[model samples]
Target: MVAGDGQGKNIDDLPDEIILNVFSFFSFNELIDTAQNVCVRWKRLAHDPVLWRDKEYIIRGRAQNGRSCCGVTCSECAHCRCEKTDREVLRTAGSMPQLRTLTMMRGTRARILRKICRNCPNLTTLQLHGCQKMNYSLLKYIFEKCPKIEKLIIANNLLADRRYAELVSRLEHLQSLEVFENRRGAGPVLLRFLADACPKLREINLSWDYHPLEDVEYFVKAKRDTLTSATVRWTMAGKRCVVTVLKEAASSLEKLQLHLFDVAPEEEAATFADLGELHNLRELHCNQLCPHRPRLISLAFQPGRLPLLQRLHLPHATGLPDDAVATICRGCPALRELRLIFATSLTDGALAEIHRLKHLQILDLSGCSGLGGCAMAHVAQLPALRTLLLQYIDDLTELQPSLRHVLDLEQLRCLNILNSGHIRAVPFEEFAVRLVNLRELHVTYEEEDEVFYKNVFAEMQSQMPRLRIINTFRWTEDDFLTDYETDDDGDDGDDDIGY
Candidate 1:
């Protein structure tokens, strides 16, 4: 029987499955305050097991002047306001017996840790961000209550003591652990404890202050067979320790990111050579190393090595020559995403070889001053390119033939041309007409007048309604003064001028 609410068809007449699916789209606050109150059937469906199985709650802090103080310095701000309290979230989560994944961000307190442990015993994934009040006791409560948790992400928190490690070691079923920006350093004892306690752990991301070389070596050696992904950002005390870890985990490691500090020149050659052994490595990100070191690139990147590699990020790698870029293109044929920001040595010759990467989806060559129009010509040939970031390219004037080729790609979603002052508005307007699928277009030309942008935007909007243009050029002092004068002239005679 189809039911009606006088004027239109009734929503209650829909089947329970359809109703539940509709309610699933509603946020937690909306379901509780509006949807559940519509009718008894809607209320029941809102509380169904399927609706609350995977819960995500974002506890945002108060904002001032439209700027939110949610994650950063929320605890320090006295005026911060949260929509739901810790106890209230626990009470709501406790009512859902089938809860499996819980992600709570910002404003999480220690008091709710025990509640989560006692309430959601079946939780397999627990992610908590910007938890200011987290401590040893709260973590212990989680270990005792949520024994089945397999993946844990506690980032930007204050808990980084020995007790925190001890509590983490208690989670016997732990498979993945990501703990970043903690207060204290991850010492040798803590590393050893984690290695011994969590034998099944396959992925670990630790961005703490320091980890002893010996401890890191031991941990890597222990998890060599099981560990597939690891991100370590710490001060380099012993370079050989890094080499040993990479050599040991060569066969199993698939993704690796290392940000080392205070690296000596004597040990760099050996360290870079060790990277070649990781045949199974897929993604490699090396950041903030000693600057102007070209030998490191030559030693590490060898042909026929890292064939399965997909993403390569080498930001801050200054003076990266064209030969190095050629070596990378030849070595990593399966590359999907490549970022060589600030690599000033690369020229058009390097980009010529990049077109061969048919599988390439994202290419970022920002700050590569050596590249010219010829390089962009090759970029236009990438069949699968989706995102192209070319900021601060010195010789990039106009996207002529390249613009047509880029518009041809149906999958090209984002194009960033910030600080590329040579590109005129006319070619861009034409490009916008054919790039119907393009979602984001970022452009900036400081020398051009506001009228130029207004005309370009108006024309582009008329052609491609869905394209989002991000204008990054800031107003000069002259422009601001001119606008003030225009506003003054528009004022009536009765308007007072305060002296």
Candidate 2:
């Protein structure tokens, strides 16, 4: 068979299915603003049902620099407020018939929500965050219109008293609910209603500034048998209530996060005792109002307690002793992710103990001042270790040994070495050739060393074709020192250096 000339084929010549698949990679705003205006075929593919199955609308106030201002009111700043009306935004969503997941962030109103409910009937997940003016009637309208909603997240909203409970009760099929920092409190009636009406509910996350402890206890007790994951934070007055709730749910709960404020030594000890009962728990995260206590860490790793635990996060655990770290490695052999960020007391001995956790894949020891190059030798022994983050660990000067070890682990993909001031360009270049599977690498450098690092990165890119290197240059040390000195009371200043 003789072949015809096939030299110059354009993108427009592609099939509709292929074109639609290409359009699927574009963001909702990109499709609407840019893709649709290209041509007739692109416009048709951009509006296809496949592209709109899962849509998100982020309504942010306009900042002065032509970016979206986050979590702040428009009136308080010099930035021009977002002029796009709620109706205008909803109009785009209303056109989509196959929308299943919808997320609205900041400044969403009831009318806009009503429009979504009226339009997108297939919505199974709805998340609303930092909304200013939400009321009971609007929620009732949402529940009535969208009956299939299974997952709902309402955070940092100004909801009225009893309204949250009423709205939640209306969704009989709701399987997961996350309420964070809701201004008004829910009464016993709401708790009872959730227990009785929502038999399928399996996950509940209630945080900051919630209702009374008694009401929360009642809710947990009502749904204890079916609930699998629960995160609760309460004041010191509600300590006993939390303990009671945890004890009741211990049998079925698989994931738990407890944040207690103003707790005394006795109360903390009492709460740790209840954790032993949660034999089925697989993940645990603890944040205390006071300084990290060694006793609490010891209690958490007691033999045979939380045997199935796989992930443990103790972000605020400052001064965590070496013995506690050793105990954790021994007790939780199955642990895959261990995060002890800001645990200042951890030393090379603790890192040595970490080698026992053979199954650990992710290890974060950011801000652990005592760690040095010796610890990296232990990290190299883990067979499954992949993601490693060691930010702000000031003493990590040597990486040639660690890099040589890291190169052997085929699964090691993401490595972050941000703010480790002593790391130089020579050691990284030696092992950069061996990281064939590395997808992301975050490194820190001084402002003057930008050109040098960029050239190094360009050289590494030639060797590892798939590598994505992120360079974070340091701000002046004086900036940090000034902020640190001005606080006097040891408060974290407004200046954020992560960027």
TM-scores vs. true structure, each candidate: 0.77, 0.78
Clashes in model 2: which pairs?
A: none
Cα RMSD, each candidate:
11.7, 9.2
As a whole number from 0 to 100, the lDDT of residue 79 in candidate 2 is 23
Give the per-residue Cα lDDT of candidate 1 at 112: 56
lDDT of 1 at 10: 63
Candidate 2 residue-wise lDDT, 430-487, digit = tens: 5565666688988887778889878888988888778888876444432121110011
Q: Would you list the C-alpha lDDT of every candidate in the order shown?
A: 0.66, 0.66
lDDT of 1 by residue, 1-499 (tens): 3455566666655789987887777655566567667878877776676765544433433231111233323233322322335546655655444456665444354455556568778777777654344544555667788898898887433223456667777788999887766444333335787878787899987755456777778788989899898887633354433654656889899998877544565666666677777889999887754434665766667777778999999886776767777778778889999998887767788776776688999999888777654666678788888998878765455444454455566678998988875656226756665666788888876554678778877788778878888877554442211110012221233321110
Model 2: residues with Cα > 4 Å off, grouped in runs: 1-54, 64-90, 108-110, 155-160, 182-189, 234-238, 288-293, 398-410, 473-499
lDDT of 1 at 102: 65
Candidate number of the best TM-score: 2
